[model samples]
Target: MMKLSLGPILWFWDKCTVFDFYARAAEWPIDTVYLGETVCSRRRELKPDDWFALARDLKSCGKKVVLSSLTLIESEADLRGLRRICEQDDFLVEVNDQSALQLVTAREIPFVTGPAMNTYNAATLKVLAGKGLQGWCLPVELSRHTLARLIQELEAEGLDLPAEVFSWGFLPLAWSSRCFTARHYNLPKDNCEFRCLQHPDGLSLRSRESQELFRLNGTSTLSGSRYDLLRQLPAMADMGVSTVRLSPELQGMEAVVQRFDTARRGKVPAFDPLALTEAPPCNGYWYGEPGMDRVARTNAD
Candidate 1:
């Protein structure tokens, strides 16, 4: 069976809700759980110590916990946090930036490269693997044909790092120093008072025709259409993707997991996973099509 991984929480929830969510997730049948702040560092609902504690607790519950770092590094303070996470020995670290790759290299630590890291070719994969990269999250924009080539190239070189795909969730396409959520509320980035915590998922962006286009988080912009790959589980497994990642959201996540789990096991889910979300569903990047195109599953029965 293909493994399931819970990606890091991208939204800023209250401290209590964050804790309670993970407490429940620890009992899920997932193989790996990624924890930490992968977005703006100022969304400090959970401190480093708190994340480490949660990582430890999840590890105790028989789940593998991987610590994630920030996607954008604008300040020395963010660098300090990256250093702290890379230096830790208790859990594995997922390097989200080039600077993080440097730190992990210096420490001689094996790390997973987060999707935010730009890795598109076999040469880049080989370079990262040389620097202690044990696994990598495929860049969200790359198509399956490109990935097939890279995997084949790696296999030709006898390289054995695992390939994990971002199977479901809104695609986080870009990040910036300026917080869009703060700007949306007519607030300055510094004095914004953590306004992003107000939206559990993210503030949605609509087109001129009032159709949903994208979602605005603190510094990141995501696709309005949720990425759904339950129907593609067989193809992903055939591609030798060892793990499938589910990015955390506010609602119906347990059912989401169950749906993917059932689908991966060749059982039809009670509900259509694609229709469960308010936004339109997409699996284009997986098939090398436009990122927003909905490709119906030919194998779905």
Candidate 2:
């Protein structure tokens, strides 16, 4: 069975809400829980100590916890933070950028490559593996055909590092120095007053025609249509993907995890993805098509 891994929470939320969210997640059937802030460093609802505490709790629940580094590390402060996460040595660390990879490589510690890292080919995978990469996350834009080819090649070479795919949630497209959330509120990025928490799951971008377009996260822009792959569980399993990552949402996360869990276990009669989220679900990337296209529409109104 393909294991379920809860990706780190990318959106900002109140401290109490964040804690309560994970408190409920601890009871889910997920095998892995990624902790820490993967977006803006300014979002400090959970500090390093807080992440460690949460990770410990999740680990106690028999879930493997991974500390995720920021995708865009721009400052000495960010470097220091990455170094601290690398030094912890208590849990797995997911490096999202080259700087974090450099630190992990230098320390000779095994780490997982986060989806933000542009790992496109087998050569890149080999180089990272040589640097002690224990797992690899396929970039969101890469199709399942590409992933299957890479996995097949790796298997032929007998390099069987665990593979994880971004199975659900909004597709994170880009990260910038400016926070779109603050910009939308007519505020500066540095002194924006942590405004991203106001819009859980980030703010939705709409076309002038009132059509859903993209999501403006703090510094990251995501696909307007959430990238859902619940209907493609069998394909992911056939591709030898060891884990399916479900990114956190603003609400209804526990039920989402439960549904995927049941589907993966064959307990459900037919996987009803309509019960997942409010956004339109998509899995076109898996079939080598546009990511926002739906392979299986479940009438999720």
Candidate 3:
């Protein structure tokens, strides 16, 4: 059976809210849960010790927990934090950047590569696998065809690494040193007052015509439209995908998990356009088309 895993919370929430969210998530159908602050290091609602405690609680509930490292490591503090995460022995760590990977490899720890890592080809996968990469979350920009071909190439090389796909949620497009959310409030990045907490889903960036283009979440930019691959579960299963990742949102996440749970159980979920919040659904990247295009799903493809 294909497993469902919840990605780390990308938005900044109150410490209590974060714990409450995970407390509820413990009972969900998810097989795995990723915990950590993957965005800005400053969004420290839950500290490293707090995250470890949460991971222990989730593991007690029978959910495999993975700690994710920061996507961008800018300062010595960030590297120190990454080292701490890499040094942990209780849970598998998701390496989001090359620095994190280096730290994990140096410790000879088996790690999972997050989507932000530049793992485009089989050669890269093979290299990482040699260094104890247990699983990989496919980069968001890659298409289904690309994934299928890469799997074939890996097979030919006698390399087998579990592939995990980002099945749902807003695609994290990029990260920057400048915080757009802070800029919106006319504050500097150093002393931005953690304004991202105001918009739980990150501040929406729309065009002059009011077309939603992107979401400004601290130092990260995400797709305006939520990426939904509910209809592609069957295809993913056929491709031998070990896990399907569902990025956490502020609301309706339980319903989203239930829907995905149903779909993976051999039921074709009714495609409700409003199942996700904010902008419309998009799966074009799966079909090698524009990221925003909502291409109809067909088995023929």
- For candidate 3, which ten residues in a row score worst on lDDT? 268-277
Q: Candidate 1, after superposition: displacement of residue 21 in Å?
A: 0.4
In lDDT terms, which candidate is top?
3
Clashes of 1: 0
Off by over 4 Å in 1: 268-277, 298-301
- TM-score against truth, every candidate: 0.96, 0.95, 0.98
Better of 1 and 3 by lDDT: 3
In lDDT terms, how accurate is model 3? 0.91
lDDT (C-alpha) at residue 85 in model 1: 96
Best by TM-score: 3
The order by descending lDDT is 3, 1, 2
Clash number by candidate, in order: 0, 0, 0
Per-residue lDDT, model 1, residue 30, is 85
Better of 2 and 3 by lDDT: 3
How accurate locally, in lDDT, is each candidate? 0.88, 0.86, 0.91
Tell me how candidate 1 scores on lDDT: 0.88
